[model samples]
Target: MLASPLIEFIAREHPAFVHVPLGLVAALPLAILISFLTKHARPLTGTAFFIAAVGWASSVASLVSGLLWGRQVNLIPVTGYFPVVASEKQVLQKMLQLHITASLVGFVIGGLCTWLLWRAWRREDSPGFAERRHAGRRFWERGAGVPALVVALLWLGSWGFSGKLGGIMVFGNEETNKAAADADRAKRNDAEADLPIRALDYASLEPAGAAPERSKAHGDRWRRIWVTASGIDDYQAGKPMKPGAYAVMATFTDEKGKPGTEPGPLYMKETKADGSTAFLFYWARVPENLRKEVGGQDSVYWRSPDPKLITCLGCHEKDATPAK
Candidate 1:
């Protein structure tokens, strides 16, 4: 989905589209305020109505672009209106939810404000307006113009806050910048530390079987085992893998007691220099129904020495034969 050129262009242009409606809405209050001070209020009120109508209309485009951009980045779910923020630690998701809410609120309030302005403008342009203009009070003071100004201010505030959030999302604030730097540093450290880089590219290893087989030891899921060149012979011979050898098992969930199309988790076993075995488990995109297995995480990656792998240790004290 991310590879589509049209989606990429629309997502990229979200920031540009928002400014037009925002600028017009920001200027709406001043136009309405000026209409109240003039005796010839028709022209000024008409101008205010035009600005409000155009701003509200243009906001539809802005909202669409923003939604598409959010979906493209995976911040917003494909099936939902708001992001699913499972926890407080999901700062980006929480912020995105608020940003979407604020934008929608602004659109609704802006629509109402536009209607009010249109009614006021029409009243000023009516034939009886000249006779009514002789009254002591201004036309706006007794009509929908005042209410429109109040609602316009509210519309401005909502979009202003939404813009602030959008800006932070685009350009990192101190907290986001620090988080990004820390993540980058950790990634660099992992690369330099020689931390199971082979496990990440397990698909490049030699396949141990002709096709996937059901593994009763692994939740009855279908699994395909792959081994490093140094270990495939030993694995096939039912001999213990030598030190410095490793194997990866790719698993798929079951359907009607058979292998399903949805992928499960990747399990890796590595024999260290001392012949001690270590395990790694990675699930890049956990199915929604299986989230409870990984503490409701959308994705997970855990290596040996992480307490989370104790469950794997319980089943295999050492390298074991593949389940038939």
Candidate 2:
């Protein structure tokens, strides 16, 4: 059976709901701390309870929405499998764990604080309240003031960390994650840095009057586009293309030409490296995952370990020249 629209909607809208609880939880602790510093517990008791109550309630809603959303997206699969993007699974899983765990912790801490504040209010009305054994105060109650402060701090800290993790997952990878690809990128960057850097002159690729070639390809049907600039003369004449030569390949979708769904980051292929050709891409609009892969800086000229033909084989293989 198909999932409920409401659940899917919640999943799609989790970002919106998640923030409400984060804000409420953050404010609850601040209010409690201010009451302690001011020594004005009486006036702030009701306000603390009010904020805690709302924060707890919203946290419950946020947790429920997150679970339902997970189910909707198969993040927490109920039955059938839902495919995630190949490169994103690990980061997504980590964020999911953090979000759920922290929200539960927040709920528990908020509930306890609310109950203590209620008791504090009740004690204010007892006879000789200020000195009545500090009275009728249990051992735990005697030190409740400090513990309350500690719990509030934990609630704030956990919720904030969880929210930050969620933001990274939604926006892209975080800096500290240890993905294998990241290591590979570092190795590749070090290698590329040692090689000569050459800029391809776009207008010179094709003959002065020749128009650029264009075609549609890719499983998703992204358009296959290219212009042959300079440095391939030997390969064109049945010899190995010299190193440091250049060409440009651009992909576009039929619906929107020029800037396809994924556009720019023009790729420059050098003739040879490590017994195979090498490509360096200058990103116009960086891929979301790429930011994390490169340690937060969107540097130009990403080097791909995979060969150009294999990468573009889906459409360009048929037109490729045979190796000498």
Candidate 3:
């Protein structure tokens, strides 16, 4: 889901907002340790409670903003709690999964620690608290103080680890940088990359018709034709596309005898300098029910000279055709 501008701004500020809770939580262990040694334990215990409560509360904002930021970056799926780490090569995704897990664990631990402190604070402030014989004992040995301290330490450790992972993600590590560069090089070497790009952005060309029309030769799908400036007049006149010009046909699956909301494959034909035609068929996302049409693949990209495009060449033997 797309977030509002205000929410997007908050998500972008996640790095800044996280420091508030982290700083508070980092100081919590010190305050609790001091409370154990102080003669005036009640005041120090109250201060510890205040710090825990505020830190746990502020963590909510940090968690929410982090989730939003993760979605914005596509590291986490829109509806997923964790990113899919399918292989060892997915270094960044693996790090993100660990980071999210650590943050959640810390948040839960912090909540329990805060509650413990709150209970301890209430007992220390009770009217009969001074009269009790246990009141003379050290704060760590009394009530929930020691347990809260232990849990607080665990919380700190989890958040500290999570923060380390977050840092690596923001500032790429050796492994991450190398993986990114390799991926970029692979993409550049991929031959279908530019063809898929042009097919996806076919709308930038001039439209041959105001609305889509059903194409009987193209599986009865609704298709709208778009042509380059050099080929628009010729395409409208049923003449062959001139050299260096191309035409794209954007298709939609049928729905109740009309164009469905689901997008179908994009078909493109370009006339080369040698006067030969090149064809491209691209579908970024194929509907599940229609995956069989493309050999069960969820997406497809085929260009001229590939045996896969023989069907396209068979139909447009000479030039682009208007949808029937």
Best by TM-score: 3
Clashing pairs in 3: none
In the range 1-324, model 2's lDDT, one tens digit per residue, is 124787677667878987886787678667766655544555665577677677777776677677766765545544312323223424565567666777677678778877876676666555675564443555334322556667767878888877887777667664535554675676687644534234334534543223333443322323332335444465456554455554555444345444346553455555653334555655554556655433343544455442222444343333244432
RMSD of each: 9.7, 13.6, 11.9
Q: Cα lDDT of model 2 overall?
A: 0.56
List clashing residue pairs in candidate 2. Answer: 132-135, 205-228, 205-229
Which residue ranges in model 2 land beyond 4 Å of their true spot?
A: 1-3, 79-89, 130-144, 174-324
- Candidate 1 Cα lDDT to native: 0.81
- Full candidate order by lDDT, most accurate first: 3, 1, 2
Query: How far out, in Å, is residue 134 in model 1?
Result: 5.2
Q: Per-model C-alpha lDDT, please? A: 0.81, 0.56, 0.83
Backbone N/Cα/C clashes per model: 0, 3, 0
User: How does model 2 score by TM-score?
Assistant: 0.46
- Highest lDDT scorer: 3
Local lDDT at 298 for model 1? 81
TM-score-wise, the better of 2 and 3 is 3
